[model samples]
Target: MSDIQIRPVTENDHAAWLPLWQAYLTFYKTELSDAVIASTWARFLDRSEPTNAALAWQDGKAVGMVHFIYHRSNWSIANACYLQDLLVAPEQRGTGVGRLLIEHVYKTAKANGCDKVHWLTHETNATAIQLYERIAERPGYIQFRKMI
Candidate 1:
């Protein structure tokens, strides 16, 4: 239990958000173009975009971040919220920052008329899976994707 404050990302958050974003990319062993990063930051600040972000702060420093998207769902009348990205600063891991960020997304989705909030993690991420299992139930669905 840590004193973490979670809030929606603002235009001013770009500077603080970049390192976290890069660290997250590095963790996945993936790289993106500068153009892509710029576009993503823009989307986070654009109210018209389905993509959005939030940050978790502790002692005036950002400790974690989450990015999510809202989209129509075939099974539900309300839109579904897909939590696309989440990261906790290495020094702040295990400090409840990740859970707080997730809870923020859950509240945000509910406030925005989402019927559900869901996310996916790599099968090998055991540490994250442990916390996720405690807070959420796996619907037992396997994900398959084709990158074009």
Candidate 2:
């Protein structure tokens, strides 16, 4: 963990970031069109976009990634950060990479004047839920959504 370095993604990091992104989608059992993937990567590189991404590197390799977005919220005057994606390489799980990535988001959000940082994990992800519970409060809000 001491050797792990987490930093914002750069244009040169696309090759390293793609596998982590693909692994994340595979973990969720989902797939996206190439266009959507391209657009997402573009947004991360665009400073004007609220979407942001960072990668955790170790031994000259990307071990994890996180994507977050800042958006307005009626509940608070300051913007809220939505941690949309987080993933650690299968081999790196339980090695503190996930927590490090999440902490990175918390720090970034606070620095950007965000009121809070929030995210959702599948209810079945017990391992992740254990970590999440230890670090953040469970708001007890059941998510309701429909794919339009």
Candidate 3:
């Protein structure tokens, strides 16, 4: 794990970040338009945007990516951090890359005075759930959404 370095993405990191982003969408069995993808990448590079992204690199190759957002929460005075997406390469799944990326978010959020960090995962993703369970508590809140 010492060789794996997790850092926030810079403008130069898009070449390294794209494939991982695509892989994440594929893992979730979803797809986004090119315009939406472009907007997302741009948000990470925009200083005024509350969205942020980071990647885990090992042996000079990006092996994982995490995207999070800071937003106002009615229940808390400080903003809350929502970890929107987390993905580790298929071959690197159990090697702690996911945890490293998540911990990076935790530290970043704390430094920014966030009230808490939270995320959701598909119920069928047991492997990730195992890792998540060890590092964070399940708040037992069911998510209900109506897509516009």
Lowest lDDT 10-mer window, candidate 2?
Answer: 1-10
> Which model, 1 or 2, shows the larger TM-score?
2
Q: 39, model 3: CA deviation in Å?
A: 0.5
Model 3 CA lDDT for position 111: 99
Candidate closest to the true structure, highest lDDT: 2
Candidate 2 lDDT tens digits, 69-130: 99999999999999999999988999999999999999999999997999999999999998
In model 2, where do residues sit more than 4 Å from their true spots? none
Candidate 1 lDDT tens digits, 1-148: 5578999899898999999999999999999999999999999888999999999988888889999999999999999999999999988888788888998999999999998999999999998999999999999999998999
If scored against the real structure, what TM-score would every candidate get?
0.97, 0.98, 0.97
Q: Summing lDDT over every window of 10 consecutive residues in candidate 1, give the lowest-scoring window.
A: 1-10
> Residue-wise lDDT of candidate 3 within 1-148, one digit each (tens)?
5599999999999999999999989988999999999999999999899999999999999999999999999998999999999999999989899999999999999999997999999999999999999999998999999999
TM-score, candidate 1, is 0.97
Candidate 2: global Cα-lDDT? 0.96
Q: What is the alpha-carbon RMSD of candidate 3 to the true structure?
A: 0.9
* RMSD over all Cα atoms, model 1: 0.9
Which pairs of residues collide in candidate 1?
none
Error of 1 at 55 (Å): 0.6
